[model samples]
Target: MGQREQVATSLAAAVGEEIGALLAPVDAELLRHYPGDPATRQPVHTVYVPGDTFTAGTVRSWGDQALAALDEHAPDAASLAAVLGLAGELAEPVYARVRAKLEREPVEDLRVDFEDGYGHRPDAEEDEAAARAARLIAEADRAGTAAPYTGIRMKCLEAPVRDRGIRTLDVFLSGLMEAGGLPGGLVLTLPKVTYAEQVTAMVRLLEAFEAAHGLAPGRLGFEIQIETGQAILAADGTATVARMIRAAGGRATGLHYGTFDYSACLGVSAAYQASDHPAADHAKAIMQVAAAGTGVRVSDGSTNVLPVGPAERVHEAWRLHYGLTRRALARAYYQGWDMHPGHLPTRYAAVFAFYREGYEQAAARLARYADRAGGDVLDEPATARALAGHLLRGLDCGALDPDEVATATEGLTRADLEGFAVPRPGV
Candidate 1:
């Protein structure tokens, strides 16, 4: 067999064995909790809705509204209704309960460096030791002592690791780990990812900690913060990232677009033009080029402006956010930050719309191809050659399979595949 084919066969076996072993118990537990279809992978909409919405009277009323919304909009009306029914009981203590419950769940991703700079001192060297200590203690307390799937963005590199030299970065991060054990799928967001060296340094520290704690090497994954101009300018930027992940023993989770910092780097004027500025677009494109086909996640930076206005304006604002967000998600970026709960619904709307559109178009194209090509057919290279490339180019930004491509090309020819081209939007 060819080397490539041999390697693929071995890798498939390894993955199959690992998956069977890992998922067997998971399947059992899931079956106990869920009678059928286990139904994981629900769309996660990070709601930043107003705290007031959860007030004693408001929660019940909102629950009723949510139930109605689910009845109308949710694909799985019965399941969503159950979730909303429980959500209605969340009232006075809903905030705290929600926060705590979130902290305890196996969330796919959790970010600590909120855009508002909510959790850190303005100046790193400032006397925030006592405050830092207090913060750790509180988070530990919240651990009730159980750790959730979460990650923290520590003080900036120049920032003091601790008010006292005694509380070093390693010590602080270790404390967080001890407070609950590193979260499930935990990833540290390394802000201002300027060079490969910075990533190497963090990886080294994590290695040391893992050894000391008897943890697996490379357990901690990293999310790059593309905020600094230097990061964008690094010669061989994409190559540098690839090297860093390899050096770190394959613990790269994703790269995040840091809008404000990127804008600041470009000297962009006016807060209104921050996120969508040409500079930000350039930076995002750079990151995406590096991240393509890596299976690593990418997230756009947050919308700085909060939606706080009359209901109509609020909906309008949501529509705007939805359009922008839809563009990002449609381009295959899955996660983005939400600063307010009110924008939460917009996040969902944008993502769902984009995916729905992609699915519809792809489905229609495949159906047409199927109607033309009869029977359990073999690959008609002629027809495929005619349309495959076009269909592939037209695919939405996500995982794609050879089958999908073949399905889309059902009765085309080599000439057709050659002629088939889906020009990217705006050519």
Candidate 2:
């Protein structure tokens, strides 16, 4: 058995086995915790409505208001293209998809914000609001009108508000159970987290809640809001974001950047605070790197500019939001926060345009890669995964139809792309 080949070396195959044994623990840990992006639909954007203001119809109302703004300002594809400077090829398709998305699903992921969007109300007042929000979310779920993901962003775990935040989350989850049961897409957010211990506290809180409710151990998950400088780096100059992820104990679903909060924390003035600011980029860059293979999605923060004035002012705001959204997409941040109804139009426009603009090229590359055919740009396994992922994102966001993707990618289904895009185990 290969005597001539084996006679040249004294080393045996046992050495290879020994090496695998040495790395087995690390391999298992990475496979279990860092299995890559979940094979689920990631909403393009998350809209946060103040807890006290959220209603059963808030999702629909946002959609309607966004559509009304579109009708009033950019009434047609051509007008929208002019406002956002969409290319000639992207004009009709992107505009039509954005409008349809507004009508069909304006807000993909929604958070009833009890943090900054909601200030300190009295104890009873916050409790009532939290309960009311849960009831409304449950009703929306039952009525089949809920956003794909819906939940609350309780106040931070800082000293002054820690008990209040915990109580509010308790009331919200209890109210949801009372109304019916926890909706499938339940999301919770703990904001202004300054340390990894805060994340651990959150994990314990959820664990207790799960135990009390007789739910599965990891049935609940939440996003860690990165609103403070300390969340990115500790006083000892360590990368705290990575530590927070480990502290989450598998319940962390996302890392949501808070642009204005982070900017102010870094001493940026209100006028200069933005998602694209250098300070914001630097913080998010750290978040991106830390979350990279951890199954924790990173979402960019929002712009505060509201398109609520004259047509010209609205156009200017739209241009700003659209550009920022596009920039985030290019940087691999697939989701962001949208604060107002007016922001919806531009948020969707940017997302649709981003996906639609690159659909055909990505599809062709993926198809060629699938066939092992060489093209001008020679693709590798990692690039093939990215190309397949691009097409999948387009399909998930409704920018590209299933029929269109099937035609372009040579009969590859969503499942096929999912298989192609999944992370491979390190050998």
Candidate 3:
């Protein structure tokens, strides 16, 4: 072997030590606050249904309804591709995968909405609804028919509804306890979170529940909805979103954009309010930045345009929804909201197509990067991680298969891909 080459340095060892000492605290802060992405499969979208209307059969019913819509309108791969303006090459694969996904696991993350979706109601009515939601969710979990993740979105922690929200949450959790025990996939959302103090309150609330029930400490986590402007930027002109994440004390799982509420708050006209609007993009960009490396994922909001009415009208709505979902995926917002069962077909269509279209190229890049085999493109560590993550997400969502990923990733197993994809400390 050839002798190693030596590099000369003029600086003294003490000089380097001085700089290291100065930056030690900042390095620790970054590790504590921005520790990179979690090694778990985040669902592609969250489907929200009213708490009062939800039942144990809701998940299956929604799948059947969406399948019915597919049968009625785009009955074949060619038709679905034509309706969504998907490329010819992607038609067969995307269509097959979407159908399989709907049949196997229709809903991923589901929220039994007790807030806007359910609306204000009598105390007795809301209380019963909350308890029923818990019971049904528990039954679904035992039956293996529940969504991968399921929970409720309670009312805001504002002064007007704070007590009511707490009570509803308590009733629901108690119901779950009575039914059996909390499922592993339990999730909660604290909506309209306009203050950091509310997040702290949520932390305390969960701690109290854990103490009472003898559950493990930090057993529960929640999502904070970015609705009002104050949630993103405060009166003091600082990035309030970052502060809110910190206030959660490490239990914040996500930051969901409330498209309609946020747009209305900004005074955007109803007709012009949309996920792609400049104002919406601005807010999401801030949310995106604030969540980076914090293990807090960001999700896009939904469109109110439901795919209903005649086949022609449904097709039009499908086109719009597919376009928006694809756009969000391109922007790295992997999750969004699905308001109706009819939106499910186009939702899966977009996701399947996005991953299928780019599958080969991404897989090839990853394989080459892993082997250190030079290719037409030179990928850095971050890009390699992204490529690995892309394939993993596609696999998780059924856009790609295990054999396909394994072969294209140059013999990398699922475990290998996952190991390589996770960001290294202090990177």
Specify the highest-lDDT model's number: 3
TM-score of 2: 0.97
Please write out the lDDT profile of model 3 over residues 275-296, one tens digit for every residue. 9999999999999999999999
| Residue ranges of candidate 1 with Cα displaced over 4 Å | 1-108, 114-116, 119-149, 159-180, 235-247, 360-427
Tens-digit lDDT string for candidate 2 (1-427)? 5656544777789999999999999999988768787767888889999988898889889999999999999999999999999998888998898889988988999999999989999999999999899888888899999999999999988899999999999999999988988999898988988899999999999899989999889988989999989999989999999999989987889999999889999999999999999998999999999988888899999998999989999999999999999999999999999989999989888888888888889999898888888789999888878888898888888889999999999988888899888878431
- Local accuracy by lDDT, each model: 0.49, 0.91, 0.92
Model 1 has an lDDT value of 0.49
Clashing pairs in 3: none
Worst 10 residues of 3 by lDDT: 418-427
* Cα RMSDs, all models: 14.5, 2.1, 1.5
